[model samples]
Target chain A: MNSPLLDVRDLVVRYGPVTAVDRLSFTLDAGETLALNGPSGCGKSSTALAVLRLRRPDGGKVRFEGRELTNLTERELRPLRPRMQPVFQDPYGSLSPRHRIRDAVAEPLKVQGTWNRTDGPARVAELLDRVGLDPSYGDRRPHELSGGQCQRAGIARALASRPQLLVLDEPVSALDASVRAGVLNLLSDLQDDLGLGYLFICHDRAVVRHFADRVVEMRDGRAVPA
Target chain B: MSSEALLSVRDLRVAFGPVEAVRGLSFDVRAREVFALVGESGAGKSLTARALLGMVPRGATTGGRVRLRGSADLAAERGRRITLVPQDALSALSPVHPVGDQLAAAVRSVRRLSRGQARARAVAALDRVGIPDAARRARAYPHEYSGGMRQRAVIAMATVNEPDVVVADEPTTALDEERREQVLRVLAEQREAVGAALVLVTHDLEVVREHADRVLVMYAGRAAEVGPSGHVLGRPRAPYTAGLLASLPQDGPRRHRLPALPGTPPAPDALGPGCAFAPRCPLATAPCRDHEPEARTVDGRLVACHHADDLSDPLREFV
Candidate 1:
């Protein structure tokens, strides 16, 4: 209870000579919805990736629940990944188009070593319900659904493992104007119900204004208050 | 009206093979007005802008007419009268050549300008857009410049010809807030200089509020609402238009859950018999499903909705 859910300070991430994220600092508490917003190439996405250790940071500290995540090896970080997962910008790319929605949603539970044969279907059904998708859609593939539905499927998958912190990277940026609101409102509702902490990343300010409790603006490689 | 109107689109239809994208859409852009055609992706916004310049795919079965208003629609006159500044500016420029060469080639393609004259016009275009080092940057290729600057360069190439109408599609998508405001200001200034009609297509509502004089909200493939910018955006009549306004989240009053229309936007071919938006409309009735809504005037705003008469106040005013 003493430790922050996510504590990132002086985080530096680089790509060759260009520093993608420069000393970006932010912290998140339980049930807080934080948005990282900036123009394109502002290192907003890079910072989100660095937190999940998808992209290694060149320097700085990353801690989640008193655990030092920056220095952890891939094997050491494997178990911690379930509690922290990323919902990518492109839901179609993030989820396998070939896999059924149920299978996609159940993947995270299996990855975190908690999949029981009997409980898998029930858990998947529960998650699909949580994200406002019909249980019948458990068998539907990614392409069969619309953009908004696909995003909901991606969210269903992200919530399957009951992660404490979700790093959502421009999750709704690619959605239609009307559809974006549906997804954003759903995210807000889900956060309130589950007491989930979300690190929402997006380039649009209007969308972020309604969704984020606090917003951090990134420029070049640094993070500043919006 | 004859001299004041810069570009007038009359029943313009752009098709791809058998699929018609823009179906008899008509609009008029005046000398000083900022005309906006706003909708989600696949709403014929880009195609309408492309059709103006006759840049629709080669032999894509384009029909109907795009009158250059008072001017001739001949290739020579049309090119000089109207120009398109595309959305993806970096990719629009040839990767193999320098920015200077691309700009020069564009000018040479239409006008009788010499290579040297074209080069100067290119530099002036960049200068007009407020790029800091216009001369030095001319030698740089599209890849060398940042997204915002490259977009500026593309804009420069379009404005270099001093066209009468500048139709830009999603010009601010890749830019930051500061750069977006700058580009809009530059466009407004350039429109004044040439007395060009500026037709912009964007999904961003805020950009429309700031820059546009007239607003046209397209849903599916047709114009849902058309009127003065403040009337259309501030007080929308169409249910689709109202849905869009409610969907956008602003930083003011109670941050209620963003009100979202239930279903996805209808696919182009899947448009229903009555209203294209009926499937998602909360207030839709049997008549809404029987007859296609016709254009009706509500508070001076032309909206294609059966329920437009019911809408008296601004959507935000409800809050």
Candidate 2:
């Protein structure tokens, strides 16, 4: 049988003496969305960070594509880092203010040793267009774009990595309602086209209910039974 | 018109250099009523709220009149007759002073009260806002209190003066849904306890739907619609209001995609000669592009749209 794209088993995360995530378990298949629904300080973000190995889990197993990630060294995980990417809440903060949008999107490709001088600029423009941004936006800096446009640019940057899974932490919470729908629609279209697994973390229940395929309600670092 | 309104704002205009943020806005806030001003971020709702309090930023030119009880000197009556509950609760309070001490100072600022009497009133105000162990919690600094507690304390401080009007500018935007509801409930209760009108400026339509009695929908620094919240939200006459409502996710079966309004709000300095929302509006006609529609009463609501009368189902285009 084909395994799920991502499997998290009994995940436990700690910050010094405080327990942030306690015995959490969830699994996601390719092209499926699993939302961590909770209020603030409920460990939803900590779980996302641990899943991406941005913060090492104190005790748990993060199995991605049939590989155990918790025991892997930083050197071992470097090659696999592009497979899962994180889209943070603050769009402006995620992208460098000084860098142009094209450079920001192309940085991933260059770092992963896939950049060619011939077609690299074209690829960045393609990525920008794929995420519903105008190709001309690539020349502008993060501050030059609106909140929604910046978020779209951030998504374009994430897509440049050609990731299999995305850990979106309150991706649209900072955007206005009118702009948020467009971003959500773009994300849905990308997931269908790319078959990307999503770990969607959000506090708004209506958004979670509308966007997620399956949901795990969390409170105080523990999953509450639905 | 002047006799019934607790606070009447007429032809309000605020300009920063050549850019006019709020232009030709008018509304009346009745006594003990919840009047909500809702729109997108750059729709000038916040600027309108600041103008009502006579607190527009430095070097900004303001025109028109804001009269409270027939008095145009809003600066003199700011803290005593009307007060503000700001968005950031922590910044509204002093980090060094105890939460209760700040409330006492607010009370003592307007009234000539003894220190002991002011302190007693401060504790009582905290107790009224559902803060547990009000006396002890009052002694804690702003940083010591939780986010929710600090918000409730600010609400208490805003109402402690017993002002005739309280303007809350996106009071609960930073909170989650549960905490948002709790803080809004506290604000509502305090406003009721003090018998003061509330001018709530927010981008959250759900909050306005549940809390407001009357709502003013703004678009591009102009009123798109204004009426009873039930009438306006239920059967919106303006296309801008309808489009905004259609974009919200509901509590039923999930749709594949939300009908979002395309494009962004125009820059304040970049407005065209026609209606502000004409470019993005779905039902825009040639006349809509050539002429700016004036607000007129239709079916017990004020709507500024060239096609307000013809729209049978405003939500139809979106759905």
Candidate 3:
């Protein structure tokens, strides 16, 4: 049988003496969304960070594309880093304030040695257009865009690496209701087209119920049974 | 529903140079009622909330009257008769002082009370808001309290003197769902215990639907609709109101895409000659673009839309 795109088994994360995530397990197939739903201090974010290997888990395993990532050294995980990207809550804080939108989108390609000076600009524009931003927006900095527009640009940056998995932590919680709908629609469209797996961590129940294919209700660093 | 207004505002305008953030808006907050102001980010809800307290920023120009019980001088009774429950509890509170001392100081600022009497009142106020071991917790600094407990303490401080009105600006926006409900419940309880009118400014429609007795939907600094929460939200008469409600996720069969409002709210300086919402409105006609509609009674509610009568189920189009 074909394995899931991402698998987590009994993940545990510790911050000093505190156990932030405790024995959490979940799996996601390609083109599916799995939401970690909880309240504040419930360790939803810690699980996301552990799944991405941004924070090393104290116990258990994170398997991506049939390869365990928990035991990999930083040097060994370098190539695999491009296949998964994070879209954080604060859009403006995620992107460099000094960089233009086009340069921010182009940096991933340049770092991967796939950027040619001629077609790189066009690729950035294409990515912007794919996320519903106008190509002219490429010249503007992060401060010039609205909250919703900045989040779209952040998504454009995430897509630049051509990732198979996206870890979205409270992506729409900071936005207004109308703008949040537009961003959610954009995410749905992108998932449909690219077949990307999403580990959506959100505190809002309505949003989780509406957007996720399956949900793991969490409280106090443990998954509560539905 | 026919009670006299505790606070009345008419033709209120707040402008920064050439840009008018809130344009000729009007509303009333009746005694012991929850009046909500809801809109998008640039819709001027926060500015309107500040205007209620005569607290506009440094260079902004404020016009029109904000009368509390037939009195035009709001500054005279700022902390005594009206108070603000700000968005951030940490900033609202001083980190250096104990939580009880701050509440006591708020009481002593307006009323001539002895330190011991004010301290007693502060402990009582904290106890009323469900703080555990109020007297002990009251002596703890703001940083020592949890996020939710700090919020409860702020609510306690706002109600210690039992003002006539409480203006909470996005009080629960920073909290998670469980904590949001807890904070809102505490705020509502305090409003009831103090018998004060609540002017809640928020962008969460679900909160407005559950808590507000009456709601004012703002779009681009103008009132799009105003009525009882049940009528306005359950059966909206204005297209903008319908569109905002349609965008909310609900408990039903999940749709891959939401019926989102097409464009962003226009900046104040970029507004057109006619309806401020005309550029993004789906039902905009030539007249809607040519002339602005005034608030008029339609189906027991005040709706400022040319096509209010044309909408039976506006959500159908969005769906």
Locate the minimum summed-lDDT window of 10 residues in model 3 chain A.
A172-181
Give model 1's docking category: medium
Model 2 per-residue lDDT tens digits across residues B48-74: 999999899899989988999956578
Compared with the true structure, what per-residue lDDT tens digits does model 3 show for residues A135-216? 9999999998988999999999999989999999999988888889999999999999999999999999899999999999
Two-chain complex of model 2, DockQ on C-alpha atoms against the true structure: 0.69
What value does the interface RMSD of model 1 take?
A: 1.9
Instruction: Name the lDDT value of residue A37 in candidate 2.
Output: 93
Candidate 2, residues A72-178: lDDT per residue as tens digits? 99999999999999999998999999999999999999999999999999999999999888999998999889899999999998888899999999999998898
Candidate 2: segments with Cα more than 4 A from true spot: B70-72, B252-255
Native contacts recovered by model 2:
0.58
TM-scores for chain A over all candidates = 0.96, 0.99, 0.98
lDDT by residue (tens digit), candidate 1, A95-177: 89899998999888887789999988898998899888999998889988888888999998888877899999999888887
What DockQ does model 1 achieve?
0.66
- Residue B127, model 3: lDDT of 100
The parts of candidate 1 lying over 4 Å away from their true place are B1-4, B16-19, B74-78, B253-255, B314-319
Which residue pairs show backbone clashes in model 1? A22-A221
User: iRMS values in order, in angstroms?
Assistant: 1.9, 1.4, 1.2
Residue B241 alpha-carbon offset, candidate 1, angstroms: 1.1
Over B206-245, each residue of candidate 1 has an lDDT whose tens digit, in order, gives 8899889999898777788988998888777787888888
